[model samples]
Target: MTDKATAAGELTDIGNKRYFGEGLLRWYRKERRDLPWRRSRNPYHIWVSEIMLQQTRVDTVIPYFNRFVGRFPTLRHLAEAPEDDVLKHWEGLGYYSRARNLQAAAREVVEHYGGEVPRGKAEVSGLKGVGPYTTGAILSIAYDQPEPAVDGNVMRVLSRYFCLEDDIARPATRVAMESLAQSLIPEGQAADFNQALMELGAMVCTPKSPSCPVCPVGEHCEGRLQGRERELPVKTKAKKARPVFRLAALIEGTGAYAGKVLVRQRPETGLLAQMWELPHIEAPDEEIWNRLDEGAGLLEAALAEDGVRVKASNEVVGEAQHIFTHLVWKIKVLGAAALEERYVADRTGYRWIGPEEFENYAWPNVFRKLLTEYFLLVRRG
Candidate 1:
């Protein structure tokens, strides 16, 4: 078979391709969800929504998208905004790196592309956080270019329709999927077609149980016909997240600093970079970490290593967990009070802030909820 024939494969017959595209387009136009992002073809708007939608559900991203655009109405606004302000807005969204990279790419656009989202594939793809999928999404959705936005949803839909058994987790499979997706895009309908594929995957051809009976293109679905619809889009399992134990200090204020807690900003790099949280230290093991008394002593000694002294109480303030792709932080928050009065003001990345000033800093969701709850109790007393 020729290279074109091989790439096209047996499923690329003209009649089948035409039927699939037309059916998807018709179904999408009539049944598409009224998402906020679908209201415009503006590249910036589409770009932000696409980024926000990554690994996030549509219902969850709706308010965040609306608020984000409302706050940073233009690319110039996002480019010029402070990193803290951007992170503050993206506080609960998780994957904070997305917000940071979006701002960085926005700055690059303002400096190079005259503050407008560029039309060229290379230019769009060159921006920070703009991967192959995002590049295709921006180009096809905004510029109406016939690029394939083949994310998981698109991959799943294609795999089921064509009965592809290749592991969707593999990079080579994604390239093949992208090629197939691009080929299927009808002329001048790139945006709608791409969205339609995603819609079908998300709403009908779901991972657990596909709604094959009501699927728009169910008539010709190879996976369903062969009774392999549940397994066609083969994917390897990801590594389990490793668990970590740590103790955090919820130090109450004293003397000059009253009705406040001690908080610190994380280092400029690494996991949860540059975000604020209560002072904490990694425990040697879960046994020591679970023992409130030993944990308090360990927490005090750990803080002393950095020339800051805190006398920890035996009381446990709260417990929370923050899960990342690779690890899970099992944090036990303990009540404590500052022993070093001199460092209570503003020493290094540490500071004492009251409940009213919580908005001034961006905190991880786990810490935010812990501190917010603590303050509410303080207020009630």
Candidate 2:
């Protein structure tokens, strides 16, 4: 019923699958990292961990995840929280959109899924931002389904084992890996097997300088046999370098009180949305200083950059440098006198809040710290 080539291919697939399970599992059971996420099977906890772990390191995610779970223990709690409150809890986590998305997805779950994290892969994947990998992880580890959640660790392990040189981001690689994973998804023990493979790759079959000699399946690793472990998981293109930006903001120094700073809320979209930040300009120019001299600095240019419209009516106080994960913003702080106008017309998306209000305004930690440092310097001066 089968030709020799077909039979050989099947046998090879079996060998690879069996070798992966035994090797990775044996190693994982022994050397799995003592991560907080591993301590629970509750779908909500698993869901939170999966979301936080995206594009973030395990070490970096620990405190944030702990704080997030402590603050919002369940889906219902997160679903009902205000966006700013959620952003407050998510401070310093960078990638604020993930927090926003998590809350959005939570609301969807409460409304449509009976306040429970969906167990079906299709249902889970269909949520706001859950992708195939997250869907697989939720269904496999949280729901104990035989779904495979492939991440960077899994990609590296598989690519090295199969000696695949294709870029893991490519769909062809995903398809091939999914096919292999389907064949290997253990008949009845999906959770342990999936976790075991992930743990092993994370702790042993790591991307760089993996522990090969102690690897339980080192003998079966194609890359190991070929001495090409570090060379697998080849990326198609290098990440392009982002440009640096100078930040300039005005603080109301000549106002009625004369020492307080000026800050406004960013729009409720794009980067740093709904967060309180100082009135700033990109190319701090002659027009900025001219407006500052008249106690009515201009904010029109910056607002235009963000596709909003507002007038400039403030003065300069100071400046600061802020480094983002990908972009650097050098902020110029200017203490300014306020204009006697309080309407949404100032900006379709802005609010003028005083010092006390700044604490609860959800400014990025970088800006918050900058304001603090600037104040301290002025006090000392």
Candidate 3:
């Protein structure tokens, strides 16, 4: 373990630590946003909010959070709910794995900890999807354990205050920041101090054009003094998302399946797992994409591989785009009608869902948008 003297070497002179810590906490008490999660110190609520808040903005998460908690209400409630229903609530939130892990962890908590969120570091860290940052946030915020929660916000604030130029995207830099953050927490003030750091970063020490003048510890901020606030928390650029073209089959149902559309469940594992979507086939390249008839043939062939036969029409119904972290999908919707009224015996994964039944199954935002547009088009006709 590195000594505090070495870990916080250059940052040692940034005013008295007590002044910065206390002043920030005082400011937080007066200015902290009254978010739904802050209303209680329940570990479960904090855990849920923290998970949802990852890679998502505060304002955007508010309604989702309210709805999620309203539906689940408690850890047990979440654990008991169907995974599909849970995904339904989290449909548009993205980073869907977070929801899955949250439910898995909730079940773990119920079975292993008597339905209570564990307070100890080791126990909490063992929970699925609970990383160091989340572990610290729950322990400090809910249990008042004086642990450090070093997320991007805390790292940015600390980097600017201490003028540390380490790349926050690196693992070593995060470890160092965690240490520095842990040292700054005053005894028994972990909740307020941690929250204050995050609040300052969000509202004042933002990524761009930080409000340096209004910062409580502005005078002591080394990055501000050096005029390098914007450059301190350096992060490497992420790789560009690769584009993928796909042909989505808007299969129209007939006979017993009339007034319904054909949808299939994604495999139980991997990207967008367990969500329902329109049957789609990846177009080989720009050549395949340029020819709708050829693309329709490929879509039909792909569906046959899955044991469902259909004849795709050349007409394009609509188009949509969805971007994941590493991939971008440019989709072209094509009309199709089932060649046979009944699918093969093992067609359980595929279903004919009516417009009104759309609410029962969780569709990724891209598919949901496509289906909505298709339904509106039908209604107009």
Candidate 4:
């Protein structure tokens, strides 16, 4: 390989690094998107915005960020609120675990750090769910610490700029990218430089069809010069999501609980843990699932196993689909009625909530859609 080709893999050239950093930051000051999170320097606000922005787009996160910060306002407010309330605000955003972890970390901050976000790297990283990217982002952006946040955006920009052909999905690539990114942060310009790199990737050097003609640092980008901008940041594809067939019961209330519906709390661990949902069971095959009567029977039997009994109707109320990172749930909602009112006495993991009480429980998006449809049906009748 020629010397220039070999040099593309390393950031040993100091002049190039200075030029790239300075050019990107200059463009950022003139063109940075007017985001709500960028308006504040409070570590708490920045921390919340960074967590929400993970796996979510800028436009989608804007309203959620506004409402969340408006509601919580401070670490103490989030720590004091019920987990259900916090999850409700975070509903429809997906990745519900982030919301739960944020609250857990908030409570820790309040109790341990006197309600102030810790500035030290060790203390910040120790907070639950605050990983390397978040640690660097919070430290550098909020506290002006010269920490490098090497998330996918930063990695992509760096990988393409230096023509580094490392698989970003690998841990080793991230460690090396963090070192290279840290080196590019000009003295006392870590905040602007890091944000500028991320913004450049997000706005200019996008994953597909990057607009290189207008990129501020296009003059020195090795990937662009070598015609490999689209392929430099190679990533291993993720495994396919496993499908799960579920029979959900929209069990109607009877007797004293009339005008309400039966909902159950998920186990305290695993996916959607502690969230409320209509009773559901894992169906074995489509043969049984296609048979509405059998599906209702299976749902009733499953609820009975949990010490609750209901007479499910053969009519199917609705169906919904939800996708998680590793699991895809194809849910069929079946209508049902309370068989006997006596089962209400043992309401350990279950409860009959009136329509108005729905807001009190945090229903996962799938259940939320199903329940919304069911309520609309009731109102139409």
lDDT of 4 by residue, 138-250 (tens): 99999889999989989999999999999999999999999999988999988888889889989999998899999999999999999999886999999999888888887
* lDDT to native, each model: 0.92, 0.73, 0.90, 0.88
- Compared with the true structure, what per-residue lDDT tens digits does model 1 show for residues 183-302? 999999999999999999999999999999999999999999999999878999999999999899998887888788889999988888999999998988888887889889988998
- State model 3's lDDT: 0.90
Kindly state the number of residue pairs that clash in model 2. Answer: 24
> What lDDT tens digits, residue by residue, belong to model 2 across residues 227-342?
88988878786454454434345444343434455567777798888887766656444343444543232445544565443344343355556555666665555443344434
- What are the clashing pairs of model 1? none
Q: For candidate 1, which ten residues in a row score worst on lDDT?
A: 337-346
Q: Per TM-score, what order, best first?
A: 1, 3, 4, 2
Better-scoring candidate (lDDT), 2 or 4: 4
Task: Give one digit per residue, the lDDT tens place, for model 3 in 121-145.
Answer: 9999999999999999999999899
RMSD per candidate (Å) reads 2.5, 4.7, 3.1, 2.8
Over 4 Å off, model 4: 1-12, 285-287
Clashes of each: 0, 24, 0, 0
lDDT value, candidate 2, whole model: 0.73
Q: Give Cα distance to truth, residue 71, candidate 4, Å.
A: 2.1
Off by over 4 Å in 3: 1-14, 344-346
Top model by lDDT, which number?
1
